[model samples]
Target: MSGFWGVARAIIGREFLRFVHQRERFLAALVRPMVWLVIFAAGFRAALGLSIIPPYQNYITYETYIVPGLCAMVLLFNGMQSSLSLVYDREMGSMRLLLTSSFPRWWLLFCRLLGSTAISILQVYTFLALAALFGIVLPLPGYVAVLPGLFLGGLMLGALGLVLSSFVKQLENFAGVMNFVIFPMFFLSSALYPLWKMAESSPLLRDICAFNPFTHVVELIRFLLYLQINWGALIWVLGSTVVLCTIAVWGYDPARGLMKRKS
Candidate 1:
């Protein structure tokens, strides 16, 4: 038991240290969403007016409506950044060393996921504080209430990243792949606009967005930030996390997975 905890601590500590050293990564993570919130949302505020939506009893500004989605954006990008590091580590042979250690592979991967999720939570809180300073504040208790949703959403995105990393064989190829995954996942979801808006435009596109796990992730955070719960979103996010984690474990399996091909 002591050994297990020890390994967990070590891996998590390593992730923290790596994040600290990469100051630009943190800046980039904050910048992308802040741009959307401050500049893009402002321009679009008049262009895309929002009616009162669920978890929102009154009509709100575009900035307020998108806060939760931007928070989820932070998690989504950070999750991918963590996966980028995993691919980098694998290329450098460090990932192989970690996997070959006496610790179980799944445990190691879980620790990595936990570490990334913790960092994502920190970044989300920081973003929320900044948003508050900019005059977009949620319910006070909602700040506290949203932690579990953030943690679960982070894990789901991080697990998806893990699954991607296991399949990507080289560091050079990851950036293009990330763009392919990230942009579609972000733009197609409820992050920028509501699903009903999408439905108004095209029911097929709306259905696609509803099927997206990232949509549920955004909805989960959005509801929690209002001190409410979206049961459907919660269930979808939970199930997606389980399925993604299972696929990640399989992807890293020695005999039957991509790791074998890499080895």
Candidate 2:
């Protein structure tokens, strides 16, 4: 048992070390959300107007309203960024070495997910801290409570990334996929605005956002931060996680997926 844990620790440690070596990656992670929260939300404040929303009572600034969404945004981007690195690693041969390790592939992939999710959690905390500095803090317990939600959400998104990595041929082609998948997933979802807002804009858009797994993820975090349990979100996220991870395993199968490409 100790040996098993030790191996897991080693894998996680290597991932953390690699992350620290690429400090610029952390900076890039912070930049996008900051732009949305600080500049974009700031500009949209007047245009967006105010309505009392769930998990919020009375009036609130547009920046405060979108804080949870932006937190999810950081994780969303980081999850995909980690996947892009995986494709790069596979091309560069590092992934082949990792895959050939004595541990089961699922275990190795789980360890990779753990490492990426840890980094995502750290970025979320940093974002919340910066938000606090700007007067958008949640309760201390709320921060603690939201950890599990973040973990689940991070895992779900990271697993999706893993599934994508198995299919992506090269790092260069990731840009087009991200443009089509990530942006639409994030925007169409209830991440920035509530589903009702989308309904007002267009019921079709609202329905799409309602079905988006990312929307449930953001809703889960938002509710958890307010000390509420969003059961629907929890169930949807758990279901999606199971589905994506299964697909990822199949996609990484030796006789198919990326294995055939290398052979």
Candidate 3:
């Protein structure tokens, strides 16, 4: 048990060190959300007048409504970035060396996921803090309440990234992932516009948003930020995390690691 923790700690420490060295990555993460919150939200505030959503009692600013979604975006992007790093490691043969360790692959991978998630969580809080400064604050308790949702959302998205890493042939392939998976997931969900708004244009699109896993992640964060329980989002996120992790573990199985087969 202690050995597992020891290995986990080492892996997490390495990830942290790597993150710190890449100061630009941290800054970029913060900047993307801030751009959306400060510039984009401000520009859209008048155009995107929100109706009374469940967690909201009355009309709310577009900035306030999109905060959870932007928070989810941070996790989503970081998760994919984690996977991109994994592919890079594999290509450089580092992952091969790491896999040779006595630790189980799933344990090692989970350590990687946890480490990336921790960094992502930090970026999220920083974004939230900056948002508060811009007068886009959630309630005090909401700050505390949002952590669990962020953690779970990060875990699930990280797992998804891991799965993608196993399939992605190389670093160059990552751009396509951002275009296809990340963009589609973000835009199709309740992240930007409410489901009813989508339904107004197209019921099919609204239904698609309802089923999106990212939607549940955003919804979970939204509800928790308001001190409410979104049981459906909770269930969806938990189930999605489990399934994605299982697949990721399978994708990187030493007996059939994609790197080995692809190389």
Top of the candidates by TM-score: 1
How displaced is residue 207 in candidate 3, in Å?
0.9
Taking the tens digit of each residue's C-alpha lDDT, what string does model 3 give over 55-138? 999778899999999999999999988888998998898988778889888899999999999999999999999999999879
lDDT of each: 0.94, 0.88, 0.92
Model 2, 168-220: lDDT tens per residue?
88888988987877999999988778888789889999998989999999999
Model 1: weakest 10-residue lDDT segment is 254-263
The whole-model C-alpha lDDT of candidate 3 against the native structure comes to 0.92
TM-score of each: 0.98, 0.97, 0.98
* RMSD of candidate 3 to true structure, Å: 1.0
Candidate achieving the largest lDDT: 1
Ranking by TM-score: 1, 3, 2
RMSD of each: 0.8, 1.1, 1.0
After best superposition, candidate 3 residue 144: deviation in angstroms? Answer: 0.9
Comparison by TM-score, 1 against 3, better one: 1
